[model samples]
Target: MTTTTPTPPAPTPPAPAPPRRGRALDSASSFLRRRPRLRLGLLLSAPMLWLGLAYLGALAALFATAFWHTDSFTGQVVREWTLENFRTLFTDEVYRTITLRTIGIAALVTLIDAVLAFPMAFVMAKFCSPRAQRILVIAVMTPLWASYLVKAYSWRVMLSGNGVIDWLLAPFGLDSPGYGLLATVLTLSYLWLPYMILPIYAGLERLPASLLDAAGDLGARPWRAFRSVVLPLTFPAIVAGSIFTFSLSLGDYISVRIVGGANQMLGNVVYDNIGAANNLPFAATVATVPVVIMLGYLAAVRRTGALDNL
Candidate 1:
């Protein structure tokens, strides 16, 4: 009877179920269960999309302008795509000289800002009380709310040959009037100084007092402690501040034009192309340089996380 029943085949274990045709749905559900990337993507989609479009539009407009040439007869930007204006800029020695002068002057202003801002920031961070720190921060940043154009014009009133310094020095033999690169650089440096100081102060504020204490414990002099510990820690903010000063100087059409005499930067060249020269394409092309440089700098600053302190 056992043989006849074939020993009643041991109960077959049920075969495992195969993955279904709706595999994506199962996968998606599984992803949702594990990762929040989908939620992040949904949240960020709008702003990312908008920013991409805006940058694309700006570049497109600039490139389009670059290709259009200025008509010699009418001084108007004609639709004809050409490189004559850029070529002319390269060939003209006078424009080249002005360009170099602009770069040199801007660099000088940035250097001056760096030299003066570091110690001031270090002092504020390590020494000043929290209340004093708050006041210092306000004092540094308050200048920014003032109109930039007004500030630049204020230099005109001060740096003119008969301005404040000259008036003071008039008591001595120095009666010469001075309104040129020297005056321009000085004014620009003072105007942009606060922008550098605030970032640096903020960086200093974040430094751990423990590090300075360690430096002191190790027999390092106060200056050595600052140089090795404090300065090194705050380097990112210096870079950040320098980047700001550089970019601001780069686009400083208003200040230079107001005070720079015959010295014209790339900004002036671009402005002239659009307004005085009436060549949109050349203006667009010239303007593209600063925008690109600014974007690259902004990206660099973001990577450093220095602006986070601000």
Candidate 2:
């Protein structure tokens, strides 16, 4: 009887109450939930303020500065507004030459990068297995981790008269192009090649294999299918990549300085004006050319529906 009398089950301990702050937090969260737009506005306010101040506001100031003239004697940015900087940019043959040369180099670099990236990207996206694709992607991206200056200097050495490239080609009676526009173009193409490859790879990877198969089935040869299906589909990616290459090259002064020898691009002009010549107004005016060019380019491509695709 004693054994059969079971001890009263111990009363279960009451659950610990939630902390007061947790309840306050829940209430706050509930408040935010009730006004999503306010929450969103609060969230966006910081970034919008930063973007306005650091970017748009700076750009507006720069545009304003471009309209002003510099005081030569004091080498100070004069607040007086004038179109003289723009008139000089337009009328000066040196500016015209530099502008054209810069454009040519940018275009050449973009063309080179696009040509080189497509085959590699296509092979990676279409032909390679997932593991192989990953390896290739890693290979393409590895160089990007290296300093841009390091790569430019490396190319400078390679293109030097007795450097790696010339040493290799010496026996073959071939020589490096040496330091000039060609060198600048090559260095830019090499630097920006990964940018070109990544976008085209993403675009090609997104393309359905069935479309390519259907093209092949419909009496299209390999080149024809690529020309009709692949190129059209990938054009937006090409444009996207070109934007990086072209804009980077357009604004680049460092690489040219490192490897360009006597050559000077638009960027050099801007730099010289800002530093050597002490002409901030002229420098700002020169800087606006690339901005205007990029804007015009975007506008032109907007009609192609490519801007949206990017």
Model 2 earns a TM-score of: 0.91
Best-performing candidate as measured by lDDT:
2
lDDT of 1 by residue, 1-310 (tens): 4477655568776647636876887777778777688868877888877776777777787778787786779776688777776776667896667566666776888899999998888788878999998888888888888998898888878767778877888889785345667767877898899878888887888888988899999999998987899777888888778877887887788887777666678888888877876778777776766677667777877867766655
**Overall lDDT per candidate, in order of appearance:** 0.78, 0.90
TM-score of 1: 0.78
Candidate 2 all-Cα RMSD:
8.7
Question: 1-310, model 2: which lDDT tens digit per residue?
Answer: 3567675567567647767869988778889999999999999999999997778999999999999988878887889989999999999999999999999999999999999999999999999999999999999889888999999999998898889999898899999989887888889999999988988898898899999999999999999999999999989888887888888999999999988989999999999998989898899999999999988988777766565545
Task: Tell me, by TM-score, which candidate is best.
Answer: 2
**Model 2 misplaced stretches (Cα beyond 4 Å):** 1-18, 22-24, 303-310
Provide the lDDT at 244 for model 1.
Answer: 71
